[model samples]
Target chain A: MTTIADPKAPRPPKPRPARLTTRGNTELYGWVFMRASGVVLLVLIFGHLFVNLVAGEGVTAIDFGFVAGKWASPFWQVWDLLMLWLAMIHGTNGVRTIINDYAERDGVRLALKSALYLAFVLVVVLGTLVIFTFDPCPSGSPADLLPSFCTA
Target chain B: MPDALPASATRKVPAGTLYRGREGMWSWVAHRVTGVAIFFFLLVHVLDTSLVRISPEAYNDVIATYKNPIMGLGEAGLVAAIVFHAYNGIRIILVDFWSKGPKYQRVMLWVVMGLFVVTMAGFLPRHLMHVFGGE
Candidate 1:
């Protein structure tokens, strides 16, 4: 029995397109981050080099005193804090890419990445702690060895 | 997959361009090498810098060792590596984002090298003087 079909049937909504990658935009974001961080790091690092290595007396001037002097200021504390975080993240990602490239064996790649992540976490955490918790002067230390401001 | 199949056994006789790679490929290799070197250096640098938390004397003592002439020259090399990596990194960014960047990547590499030499020129003499000047 052939029956005439109704001309006014409603249509179903269109299905979403299949994802090209299961991992999504993670790699893309990583790529973008490298470039973005690379730009900022140029300024941070170049200024760092200029002050530390190219300034008056150069590397010879660096010591506990010099470091304490710098860190005593909130400005430099923040500078170093930013440098620490950004440089580590940027550097670690670069290494991760290299590992993915050369470490053909699965287990080797996994082992290498494990070690890398462990180092990254350790360094970042320790560095952040040292920066925030650092003391310009100790109670019993000889004042001569410390930054002059520490005694003053 | 065959262990016995050395390329000499095939008829191909190394005819094309010898695969030494041009500017783009070499720049990529250089960027990776310098990046790895900088990564390792950063690790050591952070560790050494952290010595300050222990005691002022401890930190100073470790840092003073770096003032020697040998380490001074090594520092120069380190700076050189960093400069190259930095400039090449900018080039890479341009290549990725700028529409005309791929066409001029070779030129950009030259520009990177040019800038690198200038920066090192400004840096080395000053640093070497500080290290060896004995003032």
Candidate 2:
């Protein structure tokens, strides 16, 4: 019987794979962050949902005045702010992974990731600003433009 | 089944016939789907919530549109997706980081699933109460 060559036999040294050249444990840390942030998001998102949709008059209670009242409290403000940041980053990273997996061409991957990052930055910045800088009652605004509680 | 097949037929295995029914594969699929769902929801959530920055009348009118019963069911679905995604995400993290995690990955999946059920059982009743109990 003719003997076949062993594929597992030791081979000559070759050049290092290019992937090893990339920087440190960023991806590893990101994986960890996804889990840690997920736990936090569970609490933050559910709390937000519970308060907005369940407590008191449920969905009908979530009027402009309702939001104004909630944001007036430091607790709600911080909770929302944390939720905004965590969810945005988590979602962005998730999409980035998907893009990397599906976008075979380097140019396409770069374009898609760039767009994702831009959207992430825009939403997070705008959402954070709206959360912290929101004024239930704007100075000199018409009474009709304000929430009922704001006029009161 | 292989024995019943003719030797020629058995020798020529069909292309693209490999079944991917592993727990890990299913978990990855769920993670991707749930991740996309959450991402899309975030987009809508940000847009709607930013209505607060606009005039109160605009914000109130937009929110008022979400008061329908159908929206309530949608909210429930969102919660379910979040719960499953979060639980599975934790499992993935453990598998990646813990030295012994890969060996126990299957066990961890079941654990995560169990926790998901328990958490949902606790939250869903309260949510339904608020949904159908009326104002």
Candidate 3:
């Protein structure tokens, strides 16, 4: 039998083999996530655009009252929440892969990825908070501008 | 990847253009470009949207900028990028998952482009009317 030395076999500590793939399935999952999230994002974003820019007065109708009316409903709130999370995650991962590819230097890649991740965290957190904690109608505000739902 | 070519490779091939393959490579490039553009816009958009928490006036004031003609044109372009990215993304998913995807990838790219044109055609006229309809 040919002697096949096991890489993980315990022996005297020697130089670790070059190009050892310690990252098992991480890249694979990232690839799969991109496609999966992408499929859903196409639907979510298309609907979002259609509603916000195609229906009603289109872009002209988008205002504080417009946003307030939509978010007031649990349905749209959940809808936006899903859109926010999925879009951010998908965009962040795509950017991260690009940074890894183009930023050749180790320090450069690290710095770029750090900035990318920071933006991801900041955007995701802020969006989530804004969606859930949003007060559609503040007290002592412009009554005329407020959505009718606020009066009710 | 910088290693030697295969045994049949005796001819001197052009360098630095390997990444610039035909339809597949260009589509990949477009995907990356659109993805990056959309990502930056999303960051700005999220920040603009977060202003809603500050006050209603703050939010409306910012969103009003988005209704101007210049921004209206920009929105059209953004929608174009989004439509292309969305359709191409579906094409990529099909290529990865479908059994007959590779055989028909070129056909699917055409399909993607076709869908993109039809979608933008539907969106642009109405959106431009809203923006420039002087309402």
Which of the two, 1 or 3, has more DockQ? 3
Q: Rank the candidate models, highest TM-score first.
A: 3, 1, 2
Query: Between candidates 1 and 2, which one is better according to TM-score?
Result: 1
How many residue pairs collide in each prediction? Answer: 0, 0, 0
Per-residue accuracy of model 3 over A21-105 as CA lDDT, tens digit each: 8568988988999998988888889999999999989999988899899998999999889989999999999999899878878
**What TM-score does prediction 1 earn?**
0.87
The DockQ-based CAPRI class assigned to model 3 is medium
| lDDT (Cα atoms) of all candidates against the true structure | 0.91, 0.83, 0.90
* Residue-by-residue lDDT tens digits, candidate 2, A50-150: 78766676665677777888888899899989999999998999899999988989999999999999999889999999998999887776676556677
- Give the docking tier of candidate 2: acceptable
Best by lDDT: 1
The residue-by-residue lDDT of candidate 1 on B41-64, one tens digit each, is: 999999999999999989988998
What DockQ does each listed candidate score?
0.66, 0.47, 0.75
Q: How well is candidate 2 docked (DockQ)?
A: 0.47
Candidate achieving higher TM-score, 1 or 3 = 3
Considering summed lDDT, which 10 consecutive residues are worst modelled in model 3 chain A?
Answer: A15-24
The positional error of residue A32 in candidate 3, measured at the CA in angstroms, is 1.2
Model 2 ranges off by over 4 Å:
A1-20, A139-152, B1-20, B97-100, B125-135
